[model samples]
Target chain A: MADVARLAGVSHQTVSRVVNGHPNVREETVLRVRRAIEELGYHRNSTARALVTRRTNVLGVIAFDTTLFGPAQTLSGIERAAREAGYFLSMVSLDDVSPDGIVAAAEYLVQQSVEGCVAIAPQRSLVDALAALPGPHPLVAVEGGEGSGLPVVCVDQVQGAHDAVRHLLELGHTTVHHIEGDPLWLESEARVVGWRRALEEAGAPAPEPLQGDWSPRSGYALGRSLVARRAEGERVTAIFVGNDQMAIGVLRALHEAGLRVPGDVSVVGFDDVPEAEFLTPSLTTVFQDFAQVGKESLALLLGEIGTERNGSPGPSATERRVVPARLRVRGSSGPPPP
Target chain B: MADVARLAGVSHQTVSRVVNGHPNVREETVLRVRRAIEELGYHRNSTARALVTRRTNVLGVIAFDTTLFGPAQTLSGIERAAREAGYFLSMVSLDDVSPDGIVAAAEYLVQQSVEGCVAIAPQRSLVDALAALPGPHPLVAVEGGEGSGLPVVCVDQVQGAHDAVRHLLELGHTTVHHIEGDPLWLESEARVVGWRRALEEAGAPAPEPLQGDWSPRSGYALGRSLVARRAEGERVTAIFVGNDQMAIGVLRALHEAGLRVPGDVSVVGFDDVPEAEFLTPSLTTVFQDFAQVGKESLALLLGEIGTERNGSPGPSATERRVVPARLRVRGSSGPPPP
Candidate 1:
C-alpha cells in the first residue's frame, strides 16, 4: 500500500481509500493508484491464509422466506447462534422451492465449501436429495418431520396443533373448524393430523378443513367463505388457522362480516406472530419456539460437522431433535357463541 | 487422487465423498482417508485457486433482518441479483443493529476477502466505519441517506412519504397525522422530514407526530393513545403510519374503538408490504420498490468494486441512485368525514 502510495504520489490513506472503493477519491488519482497497484501486484492476504488453515468458518443454509412468521424468525435465531459459536452463516434461498431448485442451490453451496448445511426449505424432494448425498459435509433438515434417513431438527407442530384444538374443545366449542397451511409443507399436514385426532377423541364432527396458501389474502378469502358457509346452515364456530399471518386475515374477514370473535366465532392461530396480540380481539394461538429450533438445528449440524479446531466424525447416525411448542390462549378463543 | 484412494483402500468416489464431508461414509473409511491425507499432506484446492486468481467470487453483505418488510425483501432481491451475476452472496446479519456491532461485523468480513460489501444496517457510525476502510474492495450503503460519503442506493422514501401525504390532502383531509418509524434508521428520519414538508406545503396544521418503534404493538399503543386523545377533545381525522406492519396495528386499534376506516378516520402507510392490500380495508400506502432498490445497490457496488475477472478500477465519484416510489390509493383512504 505504501509502495503504491509513493508511486502514485498520494498519501497511504488516499491509496487505501482508492483501493477500498471510497466514492470521494478523484478519478485521476484512482487511475494512478490502480496503475501503481497493477505494477506492484498488490492483493489482500486472506486467500493465502485460507490455503493454510483449510477452514473458512462459514456455515451454509437454504431457507424460504415465504413471508410467514416462522421461517424468518427461525433464520434470525440460527444467525445468532452461529455467531456465538464462532461460525459465519450464508444461505442460498431457493427461489423455486422445487426439488430441482433445491438440489441446485445445495450444489452451489457445496462448491463454496460450506462446512455443513441446515435446510429450512422442507419439500420432500429437497429432503430426499439431502438424504441421498449425505456426505461432503453433514446435512440436517429443520422441520422435515421424523427420519427420512437423515438428521432432522423440527418444532413439535403436531403437539402444538393438538394443544390448540384441545384448548378450543375444552372451551365448550363442539368442533373446531381449521384453516390449513400450504399443503406442500409437512408442518401443515402434521397440524391437520393433530386437529383431526383431537376432534375424533372428543367425538365431535370434524368438518373437512378449509385450505389456505398461508397468506393473509388466502386467509381473508377463506375466512369470509367459512362465514358464508355458516350462514348457509353449517355450524361453524371455532377456527384453528394455520399461522398468525393468515390469522390476521381471518380476523379482518370475520370483522368485516360482522362476526364478533369468540362471541360469534372463536379463532386460534399457530405461530404466535408479533401482531397476533394487537389484533382486534387478541388472537389465541400456538407458539412455536422458532429461535430454539434454529439454535438446535445449528448445534445438531455442528455436532456432525464438528468445530474449527476439532473435526469429530459428528453423529454419523440419523438423528431427530424435537423442540417444544405451547399454546397461548388470548381473547380470540372462548366458549363458542354462548 | 489415485494414490490417495489406493493408499486408503477405498473407491475413488468414496475418497471424494470423504473429502466433501459426505456423512454416509463409513467411520472406518473416513479414518483410512484421514491417514492417507496426513501422509500425503493434502489440502483443499479452492484456497489454492483463490490465491492464484485473487478472487473469491463471493460478495459479503452485513444486513439487519429486524424482520421489517422492506429490509427482508431487499435482501431477497440482492440474493437474486448476485446469483445471476455468478457471485455467491454471503451475509453476516447483525442481531444487534448498534454501530459498534455493525463495525465489528464488517471487520469480520474484511478478513474473509469479500470482493465488496453492502451494509444494509445504515447507522452513521456504521457508514463511517465502512468509509474509513478504503480497502482493496468496495462498499455501498443501501437506504443510507446522501452525504454519508458512501455510494448510496435507496428507494425514494421522501418522495414516497410525500405522495402518501399528498393523496390524503387531495382527498380533502384537514391534516395527516404522522406515525414515525425508528429514529435510528435513515429511512425513518427521511419519512418524518418528508411528512413535515408535505404538511407545510399544504398549509395544514402539522400536529406533533406520533412515534412508533416500527412494530405492530408499538403502533397499537401509539394509535390507541391518539384515539384516547381524540376522545378527550383532540381533532384527529387522518393518519399516515411508518410502515404497513404498524398500519395494521393502527387499523385494529381504531376498529376496536368503534371507528370505521375512511369513514371515521382516514389512514395511509409507507412500505406497502405484501399484506398491505390484503388488510381489512386494503391499506392506502406508499409503495417502495424494494427489489429495484436492491438491484440498484448491487449495481452501484459492482460499478465501484468492478468484476472479479478484470479487476478493473470502478467509479470514484460519489454516486447516489434513487429508485422511484409511488402511492397506491386503496379503500383505506377516502374524503375525510364531513
Candidate 2:
C-alpha cells in the first residue's frame, strides 16, 4: 500500500480512501491510485484488514442437507442476498445433527471471525441446539419453529398446509388424508397441525397420518398402504402430501392401482418444485417463497448486527418474521367421487 | 491464550500444543488446559493464528446454480468430505456467470487467504475464465470440460449419453429424437456429442435435437412439438432428454397426447433424480455419481495444495479425474412402436 501511494505521488490516507471507495476522493487522484495499484499488482489482504478494523465482511451460514430442494433453494437465495450486500459467506453444512456438532460448527465460524450467522434450522432439534448456543451473537434462524427464544424468519408452513386441505375439503372431499414428511422436521409437524386443524374445522374425522422420510420410495410404500385401505372399503379420496417429490410417488402408485387422479382420488403436495407443474397430473401444491425467507433472514440478522455494533440490547427472543405461503390449485386436485 | 496458560499453570507451548490437539501433550496437562480454556471462555482466534502460521485451513468453493439436482448433490458431497478432512469452507455462489464475475469471486477468496479453491465450473466460459486467473494456485475445477489446461474433475457425460442412446437403439428404434439441455453448459454439449456419435455408429439418421432450459415446462413444450411431428407422419418413437426434470414434462405431454410410454414411444433421461423412479412410468435415466465427483475434486485439490505447500511445480495442467456415470434401466424404455 505504501509503495502504491509513493508511486501514485499521493498520501497514504488518500491511497487508502481510493482503495476503500471513499466518496470524497478526487476522480483523478482515485484514477492515479488505481493505476499504481494495478502496476504494483497489489491485492488487498482481507485478513490484515479484518484485524485492523475488527470487521471481516464475511457472514457465516450453517446449513444441512443441501441435497434437499427447500434447503438448497433457501441457501441459494441467502447466497445471492449476501453477495448483493457485499458480504462473503463462510458455509458449514452439518452431516451430524448432534448438539455438539452444531455448537462446534458455530464456534468454528466464530474463530474465522464471521460478523454474524444465519442458521437454516428447519428441524426442532436443530433450533433447540442453536438456541442453546452460548455466543456467536447476532444470530438468526430460518424455518426454526417457535418457543426457542431466538430471532427467526420462516415461511408460514401451517397456514400453507391449512389452505391446501381447506381447498380439498371445499371440493366436497369429506376429509383429507395426509402423508406427512419426516416427523423429525418442524415443517412436517407444522403441516400436520395445519391439516388436523383444517379437518377439525370442517367437522371431519382425521385418519392416522402416514409418516414418510421425505423420499419418493416412502411415499410409494405409503400410497400402496392407502390403496389397500381403500380396497378394504375405507373412504380414501383426497390426499395432501408433505412435499412434491413424495407426491410424484403417490401419483404413480395410484395410477398403478388403476385409480385416476381427480377422478377417483385427489392429491396435493407442498414445495411447488419445478417439476410439480409438469407432473403426469400436474400437482396442486403449496408454494413457500424460499427466496423471500432468505432475504428476510438476512435482513433480520443484519439488523441484529447493527444493534450489537451500536451497543444496544439485541432483538427480543420472540422476534419473528413470517413469509406467507400460497396454494396453487392444479389438475391433481378436484371434487371427490360421487 | 496466555491467560489460559497462566490459569492452567502450564507453559505457553504446552497450552498451544493442547489447543492444537498435538499428540505429544500429556493427558493431565491437556485436561488442565481445556478446563482453563472453558473457564476463561477462550476461543482461539484463527485470524491471529493465520497471521502467525499463514495457514487458514479454509478452502474456497465457487458454485453456480446449486438449486439444480446435480450441483446441489455435488456441493453436499464436497461439504461432507471437507468436514471429514477437518477443513472449513468459504463458499461463493455466482449469480452472474460472466468472466468478470468469476474472477471477482476468485479474487474475493484469495483475499480471505483460502489455502486452495475448488470451482464447480460446468460452463465453457467459466473454465476459460478460471484457467486465466493469475494466481490463487492449487485450484481444481469440477465438471469443467477438457482442453482448458486445468486440473478437472467431472462425471463422464458423453459416455453416459452414449449408453442411454445405445439402449434405445438396441430396443429396435430406427432413430432417436433428442431433447438437449441449455446449450451453454458443457454437460449438455457432451451429451449432444455422445447422442450424435451413437446415431452415427448405428447408421441411423440423426434428428436435430430440440433444446430445453432443463425445466419441465420447456420439455413439455418440446414434447408437444414432437407429438405434432408424429401427427404429421414423422417417426417420433424414441427420445433422450438431457435431465429428469425435463423428462417429467415430456412424460406429461406424451400421456396427454395419448401416447403410452415404452409402448408407442420410449423415453430416457439423465440425472436420475430422487423422483425419477417414482414418475408415472418410472423413468429410465443415467445416474451421475455426484458424491464421487465431489470427493474426487476435493482429493485432487488437496493434492494440489500439498504440492504447492511443498514448493513443487504443482500438478500438470492436463491432470484430470473422471467419475463414471451409470445407466439405470427402468419402466420408461422398451421396444418402440412394434
Candidate 3:
C-alpha cells in the first residue's frame, strides 16, 4: 500500500481512502493511484484492507436481466457461489443492452469500489458495449464473446444439443424435428448448429427448423403446425424443443391432436427446468449445470483481476469454458412409433 | 459541472474526468467533488451528461437472484420498462441476501456511474444491509418495505393473500388450507399474516399452516401428508398453495393418491405464473402485476433522485403503493367436494 502511495505521489491516508472506496477522493488521484498499483503489480487483500480501512466486503455481479430459466438459474448460481466464496452480491437489471447502461453500471461499481465484477452477457449488445469501456477493474463475462474478449464461462449448448439429437438417432429415428429458442441468443444459434451437425453426420434428413421465442405460447402455436402434419400422415416422429417450457406446450398440442407421447410421437427438450419431471408424463430433456456456470465465471473473473495486478500485458487469455449438459430420459421420448 | 469543479477547488479537466467516469482520476479529488456536489445538490441531466461524458448510455440493474416466478417476472418487467424509458440494463444476481453482496453490487454500480439503482429485497438481508451503507445515489427497493423511507413500490402481498382467502371463503368452503412459503421472506410472512387474519376474522380454523420451500418437491412432500390424512378419514377439501410451482407438486401428489382436483380436493396457488392456466386441471391462483411493480419502483427512485436535485428535503411523500392481486379462477378451486 505504501509503495503504491509512493509511486502515485500520494499520502498513505489518501491511498487508504481510495482503496476503501470513500467516494470523496479526487478523480485524478484515483487514476494515478490505479496506474501506480497496476505498474507496481500491487494487490490488496480486501479482508486485510478492511481491517485498516473499515471497509465493507462485497462483490457485484452484472448479469443479463431476464426471468428466462437460463438467466434465473445463472443468477441463483452466482449468488450461491458468491455467498460460499465469502462475498455478497448486488444486482442491476438493464432495460436494454446499450453502451449507456454498461457505463452506468461500471460507474456505479467504481463508486462502490466493488472488489470485483462478474457481468453475465447472454446477448450480443451487452458484450459489445462492455468491450468498448476502459478496463475499470476485474470484469468477467458469462456467455459473452466477440469484441469483449473478456474471460467467458458458459454451458456447452452446442455439445448438449448434439448429444440430445444423437440420442434420438441412436434410437433408430429416421429424422428429428426441432423447436429452437429465439434466434438472437448465442445458445439458441449454437444449438441449431449442433442439431444440424448431428443430422448431417448421420445422413438423416434435416427439415427447416420451427422458430420459437422461448415461450410456451410460441411453442403451442408452432405445435399446431406439427399437429397438422400429423393429421396429414406426414408427421415427424421425434421432436427436440429448445426448452422445457415450450416442450410442455408441444405435449399439450400433441395430446389435443390425439397423438400419444413416445408412442405416436417422441419429444425431448433442453434446460431440464424444474417441473419437467412432474409433467403428466415426465419429460425427456437436457440438463444444464447453471450453478457450475456461475461458479466458474466468478473464479475466472477473479483470476483475470489477479493477473492484471501482476502487470500482465496484452489481453489476458480470455477463453470460453463450456459446461457439459446431460440428457435425462423419461416418458416424453423413445423410439419413433414403428 | 464547472461550478462544482470551482467550488471543490479542482481543475476543469479533473471535474470532466470525474463526471465522464474516466478511470484515471485520483481518489482524494473524487471525494472532494462528490462532497461539493452533495452539498450543492448538483445533478447533471443524463442526456446532456452523456454528450460530454462519452458514456454508452447504459444503466445497471441489480436483479433479484432467483428462478422463482415473482422475481423473474419483476426482472423482465424492469428490463421492458428500461427499454421503453430509453436505457439499457446490466444485471447482477446474488444467491442470498448478504450485506456484502448488496454493498458489492452498489459499489459496482458506483464505479459504472449508474444514473441510479433499484434493489429487489424480497429477503430482509439485502434491505437491512443496504440501509447500513451510505447510499451512493438514487436507490429504491422492490417488494421491500418503504422502511428506508426512500421511494418504495411493490405488489400488495397482504391484499393478494386476503383476496385469495376471501375468494375461498366465498366459495362455500368452511376454511381454506394454507401452504405457506418460507417464513424468512418478507412477502411470504406478509401473505401468511393475511391468510391467518382472514381465517381468524371468519372464525375458521387456521389449522397449523403446512410448510413449503416454494418448490414442487416440498409441495409434494406436504401434499403426501394431506393425502395420508385423507386416507385416515380427515380431509382438507380446499387448499391455497404459496406459489404455482409448489401448487403443481401438490396437485401431482394428490393425483397420484387417487384424489381428483376440485373433485376430491380443491387447490389454489399464488403467482398465476404463465403455465398455471395450462396445468392439467389448470390452476386457480393470485395474479400479481410484476410490470407495475417494476415501473413503479423505477419511477419512485427516479422521482426521489429528481426531488434530491430540486433541493427538497427527503421524499415529498412516502409512496406505499401496493399493486393489487387478482383471483384467476380455473379448474383447480371450487366448492368443497360432496
What lDDT would each prediction earn against the true structure?
0.82, 0.91, 0.76
Looking at candidate 2, what is the lDDT of residue B186?
95
Candidate 2: lDDT of B117? 88
Q: What is the TM-score of each candidate against the true structure?
A: 0.85, 0.96, 0.71
lDDT by residue for model 3 (B217-327), tens = 888889889889778977588888888888888987997898888887898899988777766677899999998888887767667666867899754675666788888
| lDDT of prediction 1 | 0.82
| Candidate 2 per-residue C-alpha lDDT over B1-338 given as tens digits, one digit per residue, 9 for 90 to 100 | 89999999998889889988899988999999999999999988777777778787889999988999999989988888887897888889888789998999998888878888899988999999998998567789998998888899999999999999999999899999999999899999999999999999999999999999899999999999999999999999999999999999999899999999989999999999988999989999999999999999999888888877778864555689988899999999999865
- Per-residue CA lDDT of model 2 for A209-283, tens digit only, reads 999989999999999899999999999999999999899889989999999998999999999999899997999
Using DockQ as the yardstick, the better of models 1 and 2 is: 2
Each model's chain A TM-score: 0.83, 0.96, 0.79
Q: Which segments of model 2 are wrong by more than 4 Å?
A: A9-14, A22-31, A314-317, B10-14, B22-31
- Candidate 3 residues lying further than 4 Å off, grouped into runs, are A1-63, A76-141, A144-151, A201-203, A301-318, A335-338, B1-64, B75-119, B123-141, B144-152, B197-205, B298-319
- Candidate 1, residues B37-72, lDDT tens digits: the string is 779855446666678877787888888773567777
Tens-place lDDT per residue, model 1, A209-254, is: 8888888889998999998998899888899999887887898788
Whichever of 1 and 3 has more DockQ, that candidate is 1
Instruction: Arrange candidates by lDDT, descending.
Output: 2, 1, 3
Name model 1 segments beyond 4 Å from true: A1-44, A134-136, A307-315, B1-44, B134-136, B307-315
